[model samples]
Target: MQGFFHGYAMNGIDAKNRVSVPSGYREVIEARSHARIIVLAPHEREPCLIGYDQAYSARLYEKLDRRFGDDFGPERDDAARRQFGATEQLGYDDNGRIVLSPMIKELGELDRLAFFIAAGDTFEIWNPNVLLEVKGASDPRLARIVRAQIEAKGGKA
Candidate 1:
């Protein structure tokens, strides 16, 4: 079984927009023989970035087709086509780094700093201070809710 994304806090978006996938986190996914990742602009209110392992992305595509079908009405279809369907495809270089497109960088407001958060099966690229502020403001009740779910599912807290 693949290890759950335990979460990590990254400090910066290195020069060349290279975001390092920590060796610890890399070990978990690499163990599952997945080296490819898909980077998509998330549809969140804050315009965050979402990443998925190849396997997970394939599954998501399958689910979308099943639910939405091939026929997306013109207007809605165009928007979906423009947003999710046409998002960038990135491949890691030999050094296990991928360049974040300007569009993605701008969407996440990642100038010199960013955070790569392990979200399990997928990850998120967030603005560091923004994420910190959001986490700081989150209710403790929500934390308990997360803890309960993780524990109930036999996941490490």
Candidate 2:
């Protein structure tokens, strides 16, 4: 999984809403996509953001095409529009930090910290508290990870 996202990290978001992308994810982004860029989009059914390399974004587009063959209906149009419109290409700086825009921040309600969990080709950026409210209790394993990270950051577990 050298070139795949497979870990978790939490980083402090600065006053300017910039946070360093975890080093491991940076490595995977470049290795798999040939660029130090991240494609970010609001998660379809979550109050979080989905981040991945450009390559994966292309793959997702192709997947949509395959899934909607010969169907030029409003449903397909809406799906493509939402998926593509929300996606943003962000370039990390020398220190591997990207500035989250107001819209991006609003999408996840991100504040002090950025919580990340890698899921294969994509990683999720979440407001830890929201994640807990949405997923924690129902997902014991994930709850443990999120709780430990929160407590490690001086937040109540």
Candidate 3:
């Protein structure tokens, strides 16, 4: 609970585009916000969906304010407006699932399945095929970094 997202999970998308949030991630979100709501947005530079709980979203808002300042200029206003406009506050259903909007699904190229990749402060939802391609083509340095991290943690690479 103290750390950021740190694992991966895959869940099926039903005909209605509903996918269950991974149970581990649900625990983290519930512990942080005591609610089953998450803010989701298409990644600005990736073919995936990014998600954050309420607390993290607030932190991001603060960061944005600091970066953009509290001025009334068009530049600042447009940046904030565009970012906010692209995000959606999605509430989980009784089954701990959320329905992905058509736009989100299309943006990620999500079809029958979603691959959840844990990022530091946010998680990403990806199309399984795209994730496979990305992993297959990832830089060799990334593999070295992962091996180093595992070795540092006393695990064999």
Candidate 4:
């Protein structure tokens, strides 16, 4: 059986805006999608980026289509635009690094570091400080995790 996303990792983004996907997540993506492709988009309710395999993108399309059911209108159009046009299908290098698009960097507010966390079929890429401020403010466990990452980086996560 294919692996599921179930842990967290934090890595540095290079000057070229490239970062390595955690090896654990890569195993899952490679096994299930049969390639190094990942689809990333701005998360709907979070100031972060969500990434998943191409197959999950198809699943999202199907769900979106079923939700709209051929209703050719603004609401449907808006939803489709967000769900389809906004996503980027990117391939990682043999080293498992992906160059973050300008849009992704801006939207995700990523700087030198990216904090990743698993969420079942997808994973999130977050600007560590922003994540700490926005999410960790309320969730103690998340706060601890981010703080630990920062400490690991000698106060740079």
Output the number of the TM-score-best candidate: 4
**Per-residue alpha-carbon lDDT of candidate 2 for residues 1-157, written as tens digits (9 for 90 to 100):** 2378989998889999899999999999998888999988899999999999988888888988998999989999998999888888999999999989889888878999889999988999999989989998799899888989999998886
For each candidate in turn, the TM-score is 0.68, 0.92, 0.81, 0.93
Better of 1 and 3 by lDDT: 3
RMSD of 1: 7.8
True lDDT of residue 36, candidate 2: 90
Candidates 1 and 2, the one with greater TM-score: 2
Worst 10 residues of 4 by lDDT: 148-157
Q: Which runs of model 3 end up more than 4 angstroms from their true locations?
A: 139-157
Q: Any residue pairs clashing in model 2, and if so which?
A: none
Report the Cα lDDT for candidate 4.
Answer: 0.88
After superposition, which runs of candidate 4 have C-alpha atoms over 4 Å from their true positions? none
Clash number for candidate 4 = 0
Question: What shift in Å separates residue 100 of candidate 1 from its native position after superposition?
Answer: 1.2
Task: Tell me, by lDDT, which candidate is best.
Answer: 2
lDDT of every model, 2 decimals: 0.61, 0.90, 0.77, 0.88
lDDT of 4 by residue, 48-118 (tens): 99989877877888898899897879999898898878788889998899998988789888888899999
Count of clashing pairs, candidate 2:
0
Better of 1 and 4 by lDDT: 4
Q: Candidate 4 has which clashing residue pairs, if any?
A: none
